[model samples]
Target: MNSPGTVHDWVFDAIGTRWTVTTPSPLSRPVLDEVRAEIDRIDLAWSRFRDDSTVAEMARAAGRYPIEESDQPLVDWYRRLYSLTRGAVSPLVGQTLADAGYDADYSLRPAPQVSGVPAWDEVIAGHDGTLELREAALLDVGAAGKGFAADRVAEIVARVTDDFVVDAGGDMVVSPRTRPLRVALEHPMDPTKAIGVVTLDGGAICASASNRRVWADWHHIVDPRTASPVREVLATWVIAPSAMEADGLATALFFTPAAFLRGDFDHHAQGFHHVTIRRNGSVEHTAIPGLELFL
Candidate 1:
């Protein structure tokens, strides 16, 4: 599957992010169409910005809402992350983000005083193939939804070719191949400069940064405890077996220490690594096999 000399690529926008798909040969039209549909399905289920989205319905009123069976796993993963991070990373952060100005209209203006985000246990629960909400609460899966979508698209691409890479924004899933691919680790403050590089044969890599979306002394990565932007960690990148896992872990690293993740986060069984940049101008990384840093 290592036909490095011949590469076929497709680039487009999906789920509010840029995406690219590369393979040894061009995929069939049907396969490409399936990939697009798969992504759209995910957006429809999870997007908070859309009035007709399932999440928006949850936000508007409390009730038992049924979702597609495929979407249950994503909701379960968010539940796991909420428990693992002790509520630091939560789908309940949707209201927190909007109050801080990452709203549906892209309004970056902070409310005078933001309201507190609800706890997962108190607000939401799963009941007989449906999500039961105790009250109207905005849910946000931006932490890992894109990665989950990427993994789903890769599944479609995998049917056509074993050799491919699906990149959704910075979250990527690379199929196994004889030769490795080199990826640059972009600097949080300067996109033109890279803090490091990674040579990868297969698997997924996802990044999260405080620099991507910014407002008045606030950023997208918020601390649910305070409903304020996180200031300690500037950015993080994670590598794991699945893009969903990698993406969630990238955001988790911002709230928890690397040492804690290495010991407790179950991605250890499947193997994972990370690189972190702190707000105080310090850098840290695990002993990742193919990582090289110039910092």
Candidate 2:
């Protein structure tokens, strides 16, 4: 039984970041390890840096892969983001990130590079659940994959207990679907300070920053159109119904202006709450009615 007072924690390193899982009840070490293994398996499917990952294999052959129902959610989210951001947030920027010296090893090395993203619109999806990429492009799921993993972490915890927090780096998913969690937004310009904190009433919260993974003028996040770094925002945070959406929207906010993300540009999807840090350390946040962000 879980109460408000109990917090069981597990920490581990994977996919270049530390992941923390806080459960209200004892989610035993074996169970947590199995969750970790599941994450490891998912990484082999989504990692851009791994030479043997499914994404890499697809890039190698520029061919089709069996897309099961499990991958449907990510595909749907990626497609929606790709359209909303007008291709700024893409699923085919693997080569661009690699050429900028952020390849699998993540050594933060610098190389003179000309980067480009493939035409994801030209990608083929079959009725039998297969996705084919016929270009010289790689897939970099980045924190979107992490976000998906975090969601899975929450799902595993929810099966046993209702109270849990799965923080995969900055992409987090909190269980019970209604408990509010206070999260501090990391300041991008200054490493030691927080820009703000918001109460995540439910669902997931994800934060992304280009400066976190940069070498020289190149960072992990690039503008799909120009094949260069996005200059508008230093960092972004987004909260949505799922960690995957929050993570993808956080990346989109980096390239998307704060104006459009506000005022109901689209109504079919869940509403998104956002906070953006600009280049000069100035911050702006948008709230949807009941949501409040404290600076």
Each candidate: what lDDT? 0.87, 0.75
How many clashes show up per model? 0, 0
lDDT of 2: 0.75
What is the TM-score of each predicted model, taking all chains together?
Answer: 0.95, 0.88
lDDT of 1 by residue, 1-295 (tens): 5365788889999888899999888888899899888888888888999999989999999999997887777788888888778898899999888988899998999999898887887998664478899999999999988889999998899988898999988899999977888989999999889999997789999999999998898899988988888889999999988999889989998998767666655655524788999999898887776799988
Across residues 123-201, which tens digit of lDDT does each residue of candidate 2 receive?
A: 5443146776655458777737778888877777777777778889878897754656778888786768886777765
Best by TM-score: 1
Candidate 2 root-mean-square deviation in Å: 2.9
Q: Give the TM-score of candidate 1.
A: 0.95
Residue 141 CA error for candidate 1 (Å)?
Answer: 0.3
Weakest ten-residue segment in model 2 by summed lDDT: 262-271
